[model samples]
Target: MNKVPITVITGMIGAGKTKISNRLIHGIKGSNCKVQVLVYYPDTITVVEDISTKRQYRKLPHQEQPAKLITTQEQLISEMISYSKEKQPIDELIIELAAGIPPQFFVEELFQSLEKDMLDKTFYIQSIVSVIDAQHFWFDYTSNHYVIYTNDNDRMEHTFAEVMISQIEFCSHIVINKCNFISKESLDETVSFIKKLQPKAQIIFSADGQVASQTFHSVNDVDLHQIKSNIGWKLELKNNSSTLNLVEKFGINSFIYESHSPIQLEKLEEWFRTFPSEILRSAGYLRTYSEAHGLELLYFSQVGASVIIETVDEHCTDTTARSKVVFFGFDLKDVEVTQQLNQCLMENNNINQTVV
Candidate 1:
C-alpha cells in the first residue's frame, strides 16, 4: 500500500501556520492530490475554514476539504488511523500544531507509534515545517515570556525562546512568513540567524504563507535522532564553548555564563528590568533567594523584552542550582553582561564582602 505523506506545520504564536496550511491545502488540490488537515488547538474554538465549501461557493475547480480540529493526543492518533483505513485515503495529511504547543511533542509521539507498530503502514511523516514571523521573529524569539496552554484539563508552560528554538531545531523545513513586514537587511539577518540554528533545514521566504506546493513535496524523510540532537544550544553546550565566532558575518554571537552563588532577588529583578537590548536570547538555570522560599533553584529565560524567572520542577531535575545561562544576540558584549550578572549575586554577610 502507498503510504500517505504527513506534513506537520508549526511555529510561534501569530507566525501564520494556519495560513500556510490553508495555502498548502489549496496548492495540493491544484496539483490534483487529495489532502486532509488536522489542526491541534489548545482551545476548543478554531478558525480553520471549510475550504471545500468556499471553493464550491466560488465555483472553483478541485474544491479542497475542511480541516479537522484535534484537542488531545488520543484524538489525533485515532483520527489518523481512521483516515488511513478510509475507502479513498488522502494523498497527504497536514497536521498543524497550534502555536505554544511544541511540535517536538507530537513528532516524538508519531515516531513512538511507528516504532510500536501502532500506526497504519499507510501513514508516514513527510516533513516538519516551522513558519517564522520575519518582522517579529527577533522580538518573539528573545522575549522571556511564558507560553501557557491549557488542554485536556492540564496546564503546560514554556518560555517563548524555548518553544521557538525547539520548533526551529526540530523541523526539516523552515518558512519565513510575512516577509513584507521587515526590511531586506533585517530579513537577511533573520535568515542568517535561522541558518545558524538549523543549518540543515531548507528555508524559503514568503510574503504571507504562499509557498509553492513543490516545497512541501520535495522534503525527504526526517531523521528523528539528528533533529533532536542538532539544536544550536545543545551543540554549543556539548562543545563546552564559551563563545560562537559569527560576529563578523551578521553580528550574531553567543556566550555561556556560569556562576556558583545565589542571585539576590531584588538585584535580579533590577537586572531584568534593565536587560540589555543587545542580548536577544538567554536561557538557563539559576539559584536565587526569596523571602518565602529561601534558597530556590529557578529557570531563567530572556528573549527580546520579556524575561521569566520561575521555580524549577521535576522536569529540570538534572539542572543544578549553580547558574549557567547561554546568551545569543548580535554583537553581544560578554564582559559587560558578565559584570551586570555578577552584580546580581548575593553578598556574603559573614565575610562582609559581595559574592560574584
Candidate 2:
C-alpha cells in the first residue's frame, strides 16, 4: 500500500489554522486523490466547511467529504490508521491541532508510532505548518496570559508565550494570515521577528488564508532532528551572538544578560514589578540569594504582562552555574539595563556590619 502524506496545522487560538485547512480542503474538490482532515479540539467543537455541498442548498450528486472531529490524541492516531485501511485509502491527511496544545507533543507521538511500526507503512508526516495572525502577532506573542483547557473533571494550562514560541520554532512552514489587517511597516516587523524565531521555515503571506494549494503540495520532506534544534533561543545561547543586526533595522533585537553573583530576592521582585515595556520576552535560569535559603537556583521568565520566578532545584554553589537571561524586545538599552541588573547582585548590595 502507498504511504499517505500528512500535514499538521498548528497555531494559537485566534490564528487562521481553520481557515487555511478549509482552503486546503477546497483545493481537493476536483482532484482524483482522496483526502481526509481530522480536526482536534479539546474544549469546543469546530465546524469545518464541506466544500462538496451543492449550490442553492440542493444536494450534490457526489458524496461530501466532511472533516472529522477528534478530541484526543489516541483518537487522532486511531482515525488515521483506520482511514489508511479503507477500501479506497486516502491519498493525504491533514491534522489540525488545538490552539492550546503544542505541536511538538503530537509530532513526538507520531514519530513514536512510526518507530513501533504502528504507522510506518500507512502514514508519514510531510510537514508542520503554523498559522500566524499578522495583525495581533506582536500583542499575542508577548502576552503573559495562559491557554487553559477544561474537559469534564480534567484541567490543563500552558503559558501563552511558550505555546507561541513552540509553534514558531517547530514548524516547517509559516503562514502569516490576515495580512490586510495591519500596516505595511507592522507587517514587515512581524515577518522580521518570525524570521529570527525560525529562520529555516518558508513564510507565506495571505490576506484570508487563500494561500496557493501548490505551496502545501511542494513542501520538502521535514528533517525532524533539525527541526527540534532550530529554536532561536537555543541557537543564540550556543553561538553567544547577542544581537541580530538584520533584525535591528526594525528596532527589534535580543541580548543575553549574564552574571556570576547572586541576585537579591527583594531587588529581583522589584525589577519584575517594574519590568520595562520594551523587553517583550525574557527567560533564563538565575541564582538568588536569600538569608533563609542562602543561595538557590531559580528559573525566570517574563513575557508581556506575565512574570514567573520559581525554584529550579539546582546547585548554586558551582562557579560554572552562572545566571544568564536572554531578552528580546524593541529598542532595548542593553548597557543601561545591564547596569540596573548589576545593582541587584548580592555583591553590590549594601550590607550593615556589626563589630562584636
Candidate 3:
C-alpha cells in the first residue's frame, strides 16, 4: 500500500501563509491528477475564504480557538491519520501547523512518534515555506518591536532572531513572499542570512505568490527511510544546581518532580488547574487509584499550561509510582519557588531533590 504524502505548511502571522496555501491548493487541483488531497488548516486562527465549496474543510475537534487544534505536529499528524482512515482512495494530505509557532515550540517527540508510520508509507515534509513580510521581518524577527505590548510572561520567551532562526533551521524551503516591498540589497542580505542558518533550503522570491511548482517538488516524494535517518535527539536539561544557568540561557529553568506516592485525585486535578505561570511544560504518568488503572495527565504551555487526560496501563507499585514533572521559567533553585511547589505537589512531606 502506497501511503499518502502529507505536507506541513507553517509561517508566522500575516506572512501571507493563507495566500500561498490557496495558490498551492489551486495548483494541485489544476493538475487534474486523480489524487485525493485534504488540507488541515491551523485549527487556531480562522481563515475566512473557502477554496473548495463542495468539500468544506473538516475542523479538527477543539474547544479553544480552532487554530489551537494545530497546537503540536503530533496532534496534527494524528488528526490527519484519523481523518484519512475514514476516507476512500486516500491519496495525499496537506496540513498547515499554524501561524506564530517558534521553532523550538515544534515538538521533537511528535516527529519521532511518526517515524514508524513514515516507513510504511510515503511521508515527506515537502517544505516549511515561511512567507516573509519584507516590511515587518525586521520589526518582528530582528528588533524587540512586539515585546512592548505583550505581558511579562511572554516577554521572557524568545527573541525575534531566535524565533526566525529556529524556523529557518527546520524549514526545507525559504519563500520570501511579498518581496515587492523590500530593497534589492535587503533581499540579498536576508537571503544571505537564511543561507547561513540553513544552506540546504532552496530559496525563492515571490511577488503576489508566484513561485514555480518545482519549488514544492523537491520534498514532494520523500522516502521514510531518509526522514528516519535524519532523526537525532538533543534534550537540554541542566543539573539541579544549573537552574540559574538555565535561566541565563533560556529565561526558564525546569524541575522534574517524580514521586511514586498516589496523589489525591481531586487534589491533583486542582493543582493542575491552578499551576503557576512560570512553568512552560509539565507532564507525567499519574497514579491515583488503588489498582493503578488510572489516567495520565499531560501539561504544556503555548500561552499557558494546558492539562489533558488519557488512560494508561495499570501500575502495580505505588512505592515506585513516580510523577516526573518539569517546571520551566520559575526559578526552581530559588528556595522560595521550588520549595513552595515541592510542598504543593507533595503537600504533606519533605521532597527536596534537585535536578542533579
The most accurate candidate by TM-score is: 2
Off by over 4 Å in 3: 33-69, 72-75, 103-107, 116-122, 145-156, 219-356
Which candidate tops lDDT? 1
Candidate 1 per-residue C-alpha lDDT over 1-356 given as tens digits, one digit per residue, 9 for 90 to 100: 67778888998667877778778888888988888888788563233222332211222233146678898777887787777776757788898887776788778887787656566467778789999988777666545456666557876666667678778878889999989988888888888777767777888889977887778774345777788667665566556567555644689888888887877778877888888888766777887765567666888766566677888878666556477788888888888998999998886572234322
Whole-model alpha-carbon lDDT for candidate 3: 0.47
Relative to the true structure, how large is the alpha-carbon lDDT of every model? 0.75, 0.74, 0.47
RMSD of each: 6.7, 6.9, 13.0
Error of 1 at 275 (Å): 3.4
Model 1, which residues run further than 4 Å from truth?
A: 12-14, 44-63, 113-117, 138-147, 151-163, 217-221, 248-250, 258-274, 284-301, 304-324, 342-356
Clashes of each: 5, 0, 13
Regarding TM-score, does 2 or 3 come out ahead?
2
lDDT ranking, high to low: 1, 2, 3
Residue 126 miss distance in model 2 (angstroms)? 1.5
